[model samples]
Target: MVVEKNVSLQRCNTFGIAARAQALVRVRSVADVQDVLADPRLARTPKFVLGGGSNIVLTGDVQALVLKVEIPGVRLVDETDKAWIVEAGAGESWHGLVAWTLQQGWPGLENLALIPGTVGAAPVQNIGAYGVELQDRFHSLDGIDLLTGEAFTLDAAQCAFGYRDSVFKHRAPEAQHGAPRGFGLAGRALITHVRLLLPKAWRPELGYLDLERKRAEASVEHPSAQQIFEWVCQVRRAKLPDPAVVGNAGSFFKNPTVSPEQCQDIIARDPKVVHYPLPDGTIKLAAGWLIDACGWKGKSVGKAGVYDRQALVLVNRGTPQASVSGGEVMTLARAIQTSVYERFGIRLEPEPVVV
Candidate 1:
């Protein structure tokens, strides 16, 4: 473990925000994590487990020790008649893992291509794109308890995954020490590895209309998992801005879910309101459409601005002389929230973990 002080976190996060970490430690293995946690100097202080830094906003200089998990390895743990069980280290890049699985002709994770973050972080948010989510393939995960230095396995039900939330986000307040904490960083519950179950029968879920359109153009009668993966990558590349060029964390807000009656009322007011029916008969409204409808797209406040193509994306366009402030991001977010609430009586929730 290499611990450095006053490290700039600009390059660490996908948003490219200029923030500093008091102490930054890069751990290549679980042993390294245990060693760092045992170090008495960092025991009581707040700690942050950073993966690909894609789903976070460094509001200010992080006061905690930012532990960057870099452990890397993948393996086929079990193979049965139903599915192939595979496990990957928490540190492995998510997209890299998806590409590797597609190469092996894995069926389940094809629709999740191009998602930013690490394997461990996937389960944290139940990452979803197109019409699939991580929970669909999740088997179990091994997490190290922070306080006792003991390890435990969390099965699918144990994860308690919901839409963009899990036990990692909503653990009982009193059971903090033993259970996973908010953002899966309570009292040492670090994800060391994640196991996934992939199907032997490749059933391509062409539920998303855009993806289906692309497949139709290709004349693909029965798209293989690999082909669907490629198409997803293409769609993402076309729609989302590359964080390397434009500073962003993809969709900044989760599409707000509301009752069917509420959706009907909003649609009655403006029939163009984009929405989709959920499995529970509820309605999920497009947050981007809400934000854009308020005429916030291409709007800028100092260095931070809403992306021209996607209203949900907030970009940093300022130079070194005019650095963006946390206030600007908050101000913009609050404005969008206020507008959406006033218009549709729905409060938009930010997807990125805002500090």
Candidate 2:
């Protein structure tokens, strides 16, 4: 439970924003978290749990004690006639977990290949790609309550999964629009392990147009799980810049869902607007398309720029020595949001947590 002071956080985050943690602790196990809670000084201090650093924007120096979760492990915990249960430690790379499951003959996670961040952050953001989401494969997770120092587990329903949202991303339940629907656990919990339920009877999810194009190119009527994984990787690589090469969070905004009438209004304005109708009656608009339509792609605000290939991704145009600051990123993001809203009458919600 050693606390390091003035720790440099430039490389810890995907955006490569220059910042430092006032105090930081490496949490390698559940006991480490308990120790921090038991300690007289840290117990009363506000803490920040960091995992993978892929889905966050550090605005400035973090004043709270940072708990860098580094726990690691993966195993097949249970196998029933219907499904295979796999458990992974919080610190394991999400992409690594996907590849591991596929290698072990598990097929349900193939559609989620190449997503950035740790396994624990997957449910926090409800990560999804290529017509599949983490909630579709989630089983359960174990975590320690930050407020009580007590360990607990939760099932899928308890997670309150939504589009790129979950209970982990919210605060305690509060009144909102005259309702009690804002139930959350935002900073109150730290996930240590995640369990996935992969059904034995797997089917390919080729609903996304890019994947269907890949299947057509390969001339395969029925693709295997491995094939689907490869296709997803290829499709993502073509559009998204690798975080290693370009300092950027994957998607900057969530695809906004709107009512049928709202969709019609947008359609009347721009008939070529890209969108998809969900299983429910709501229509999900492509945020990148809207941004591009507003002529934001290949544009820059200070050192923060929109990725030329994908308008939804905002990237750092500066070098590591003179990296883009979090403020620059947010300024650019706000500008994009304002323009999108002014043009489409839809407010764009950022996908990453702004710390």
Candidate 3:
């Protein structure tokens, strides 16, 4: 494994923000991680794990040693009457894996097509799209403890999955001195591989409005998983800008969920409020609608602009040489948050990790 100094990270991130990693290492396998830990000087350095860079905003040059995960593999590990288990290396493209599974006749991951980022980062955010979440298909994952150099595996229950959250997103308590009530993996773990359990009995996930519309337009009563996958890709292409062309992190905020009473109160004041009733009876408000209502769409604060097409996305408006800074992005994000809070009494939580 080779470690490089002063590496530019402008292209590494989806936002294409201008920044650099002081020291960077491309981790491909378990041996590379072990080598990093074995080196005395490098081992002592603070570290940061980077996947596909689709869900982060780089505010400045990264000082921590960046481990750019690039491990690669995809295959079926097992199959049964109930489900087919598929395994992928952490650095494998998430969308690629979704497509591969369908090609192999595993139909469960079709609803989450076209979502950006790597497999390792998916569980961290518990990525969801088109009525499907990663946790729904997740089987297990293997990770290496950054500090102790110990390898471990965890099942779905051990992940503590929630709406756009997992143990990997939380900080573990300081040392073995005291682990938290939750198995917070956050900075302490580097995921190496992930296994997905795709169900044998396939059922279409057509709960989202767009999917329903597509189904209606096509006049199809029942759609296959591959069909859903194609529709999702088309819908996303129309709604979301390709990061390679126009720099952006897909959604800037999580759709805030509130109690039914709170939703009713808002509905009373404005009948036009868009909301969805969750299975748990909570109300999920449309964050994009709230932002659009507050007049943030197409607005820019120093090259960091809220996307005109989809208000939930934040984009880079400047040229490649003069890209958006992390501070500018945060400033725009904070302004949007403040405006949404003032107008709706709801604080919009940013989806991307600000570094």
Q: Give me the overall lDDT of model 2.
A: 0.94
Model 2 poorest 10 in a row by lDDT: 174-183
Q: What would the per-residue lDDT of candidate 3 be over residues 240-263, giving only the tens digit for each residue?
A: 999999999999899999999999
What order do you get sorting by TM-score, best first?
Answer: 3, 2, 1
RMSD to truth, every model: 2.4, 2.5, 1.4
Estimate the TM-score of every prediction: 0.94, 0.97, 0.98
List the candidate 2 regions with Cα displacement exceeding 4 Å. Answer: 173-183
Sort by lDDT, best first.
Answer: 2, 3, 1
State candidate 2's TM-score. 0.97
What are the clashing pairs of model 3? none
Each model's lDDT comes to: 0.85, 0.94, 0.93
Clashing pairs in 2: none
The backbone clash count of each candidate, in order, is 1, 0, 0
lDDT of 1 by residue, 242-326 (tens): 9888778888899999998998899899899989999899999999999999999999877789999888888777654455766
Winner by lDDT? 2
In candidate 2 the C-alpha lDDT for residue 200 amounts to: 97
How high is the lDDT of residue 85 in model 2? Answer: 98
